[model samples]
Target: MISLLFGAGASFGAELHKPVPPLGNYLFDKLVELGGAFAELPDDIKQEFRLHGFEKGMLSIPNDSRVINPLQKEIAKYLSSFKPSNENAYVRLFRSLREYAKHVNVITLNYDLLIEHAMLMSGAQKVSYGIDANEKSYSVLKVHGSANFVPVLAPNIIFEGNVSIGCGAFIETNQIRSLNSHEEIIKWCDSRQNSDLSPIMCMYNKEKRVVINPKYLESKRKDYTGVISNTRTLIIVGVKYIEHDNHIWDVILDSAPELIIVDPYPSEEFLLLLKQRNITHTLIRDSFYKSVLKLSLHIRSRVKIDPQI
Candidate 1:
């Protein structure tokens, strides 16, 4: 069995509709163009972004600021605007893994719906988003909260203990209110332009806090642990192994699966880490689309050698 992991680079390379999503550093400029809450952002804040970085710049602002809620809403609106092309690497990869759907798991660090969109476009009728693992369907785990994931706050719910007001005035980690369709998600995003509503996304932050519901978070983590620990191969695409993401990397290290990383330029630190760990891995120095073609052929050849694979 094999599982897949994706990062922001995967989305940047994906063939989505015109004006593809930008990486973290370039995100602020894109949001500015969208012209909702971002338009209200102060010039000094923009300057801070230019100097330090997106995450650190965001952290510099107080959590309870007026801009945070609407900022998250605009993020959802902008990301949800893009539609995945019918025949992209994302769709092709899903097609390749369709036969092994039961045994495969997909984990992504992106906030966009590209993976979900690709799965549906690939003729998938049932897709699980890690909370409810379906052996009969593909499991796409969004480690960082997704654009479509909305928080459902009960009146009785109380916020406490290092809760991030950066996400919103209040954080709801209990029940997740998932928008079923793209139209519904768009409507939700557009509904509250100036309202105090926020999506369940953990925005660009160096701290990497997960805003997903506790129940859902636990289930997804379990699924991730189970799949990564026992899978024959782990395919990582366009992901940078940074120190802050040790929660993710540490698990891979402990499991020690056969790693197959697809990145045009693999960082020296990442390569060194792989060598130091003494784990078996293959580095595919290429883009996502070209790498998918190679992977498809490789899967075909492997299946021919061992039919059960």
Candidate 2:
């Protein structure tokens, strides 16, 4: 069982037109410029940003309707703004995942559906997006709620985290075509989201009150924790190992899977932590595609073609 933990940077190379809005405090300037709820922060929230910085400052502010409502809409819009071309590395990455890893589990902090699209495109026929019946299929645990995941008022449905959504505005994701282009996906997403007509999508918070499948979230955490504990090797791509993710760090450190970190600029704090902990790790100081190219020979020898085709 192998696990690939992804962050926002994981899909950076695959995005179309523009780059994704940065996670943590890097978006403070952008959010400020974008204005509206993000720009005109309340006095207390603004003070937190001034004092601590974006990451910690966000944590300080309450995740109430005032902040979360506006923020979710904006975030969803921002995440869905990009398109991945055929040449996108994610296509190759997911194909590799399908062929190489016997049991693949993805834990991601991104709200985009790039992984899902890639999995679908890579001929991974039965892919599970943390919902419905995904038995024996590739499991994608979206640590953060996805742009496609929408709030619903339906009863008897289990959801990941909890949020007080507008009772009237609820929607669900569908089985989109595997070869759907970025344009098709964007159109599909916009239709599903329904803009201001519907208030769906979940944002990341310790205790989020939004729409997502509880079954999906529960399985992801459990599987990731177990996989990290047992697997000899773990590949962490495009992640910064930030403070909000201290809990994940606890497990990764405790379990201590042989770490392969792929980032253009690796985190010094994380590297220091690895040293102090004496964790044997490899740092690939390159973009995701180059890193994959670096390991292509090893991968080629290990992976077998999918017989499903």
Candidate 3:
């Protein structure tokens, strides 16, 4: 068994005409709309926004906690409303990948619906969440709470309620408002002190804050453990390996499977880091879609299965 992991960059091929709005822009626009002022901004605010892909002068106010909180909520709402255009390149890529990995598992950090859509398009008979012990077909694990999964709230506890086409499992309306609440949002600014159960909200500037359900985190870890221990090869695509996602890297390194990395241009630093971790079986490719297709064909040709009577 082999598993595949995908990141936001993989969604880029989905052919969204408007680049998914970077976190910084989403935060900035909302802050200005809410009357958040520059003078009230935190000293490190400008630098933070820049990391998420915001230029300093791009927005009117200084990007700081005071301004960013509400902006994040607005951004979440905006993201909730985003519908993929009909002609999506990512859709085709996802379909191709799904067909290629007929017997494998896929884990993605992306919150978008492209992968799900692709699976549906491919006429896949089954898709499992990695939670079931007996599932045997293709599966997808959205590590980060997806945009199409809604959470059910019960006092201090939250659980996955339903999976809708456009809703996410981790981000509740109340959660978004809580994150936007200037007073409550401060609790998450220090990543170390934050609860791991909370869904992690990331700004384009690379700053990450946890805002997930603890239960979900446990489920994710358990599922990951099962997949990693069983899978023989791991393919990583479109992930930028940001510092916030160090935990994922740790898991991959610990798994020590045959590793393959696919990206248009992989950085030397990333390669060095992988090397330092002693992940020797790495393959870099120019096109993730193409690589996955080729790999699948090769695997299918090599494996032989008996037809049951």
* Backbone Cα, N, C clashes tallied per candidate: 0, 3, 20
Kindly list the per-residue Cα lDDT of model 3 for residues 221-303, writing each as its tens digit.
56777787776787777777664555567677677777777777776777887788787666656554446555554445433
| Model 3: CA > 4 A from native | 16-47, 51-73, 77-90, 93-102, 125-128, 131-138, 154-208, 276-278, 289-292, 298-309
Best by TM-score: 1
Say which prediction, candidate 1 or candidate 2, comes out ahead on lDDT. Answer: 1
TM-score of candidate 1 against the unseen true structure = 0.85
Q: Which runs of model 1 end up more than 4 angstroms from their true locations? A: 16-18, 131-136, 153-169, 192-194, 210-219, 298-309
RMSD from true fold, candidate 2: 6.4
Q: Residue 268 CA error for candidate 3 (Å)?
A: 1.4
TM-scores of all predicted structures: 0.85, 0.70, 0.61
Which pairs of residues collide in candidate 1?
none
Candidate 2: minimum summed lDDT over ten consecutive residues — where? 168-177
Cα lDDT computed for each candidate against the true fold = 0.71, 0.59, 0.51
Cα RMSD of predicted structure 3: 9.7
Alpha-carbon shift of residue 82 in model 3 (angstroms): 5.7
Q: Residue 114's C-alpha lDDT in candidate 2?
A: 72
Off by over 4 Å in 2: 13-18, 21-23, 29-36, 43-53, 60-63, 130-137, 155-219, 295-309
